[model samples]
Target: MALSIVYGILTTVLTATSWRLGLAVDGILWLVFLVPIILAVIGIINAVNGKMKPLPVIGGIKILK
Candidate 1:
């Protein structure tokens, strides 16, 4: 959640600064933003399914907490 907000801000800032940074944000976000978001979604889904399990590497990233 927190990381998403940070990334959103950084993305908006960098995107407005230069086209290169904007491209970098798009490319990097697949691994950086998308990965964590996907993992978090999976974690939440599992929880809703009544399966207890952490989301791979993303579960440990405290930036969202």
Candidate 2:
């Protein structure tokens, strides 16, 4: 989420400064945003199926004690 926000801010700044660079970075933004969504889906599926598995990338994140 933070990465997405940072990237979005960067893209906005870049766009304000240079349209071309911003456009290029914007193309890659989809990938950055897709990761969290995919992870969430995976987590939900795992939970529904009664499996306790670690998620890729941020699975180790301890949101709750």
**Runs in model 1 lying further than 4 Å from the true structure:** 34-65
* Counted clashes in each candidate structure: 0, 0
Q: Model 1: per-residue lDDT, tens digit, 1-65?
A: 88778878888888889979887986787586567688778888998999977568755667754
Residue 44 lDDT in candidate 2? 95
TM-score of each: 0.47, 0.58
Model 1 lDDT-worst window of ten: 56-65
Task: Note the residue pairs that clash in candidate 2.
Answer: none
Residue 46 in candidate 1 has what lDDT?
A: 90
Clashing pairs in 1: none
lDDT for predicted candidate 2 compared with the true structure? 0.87
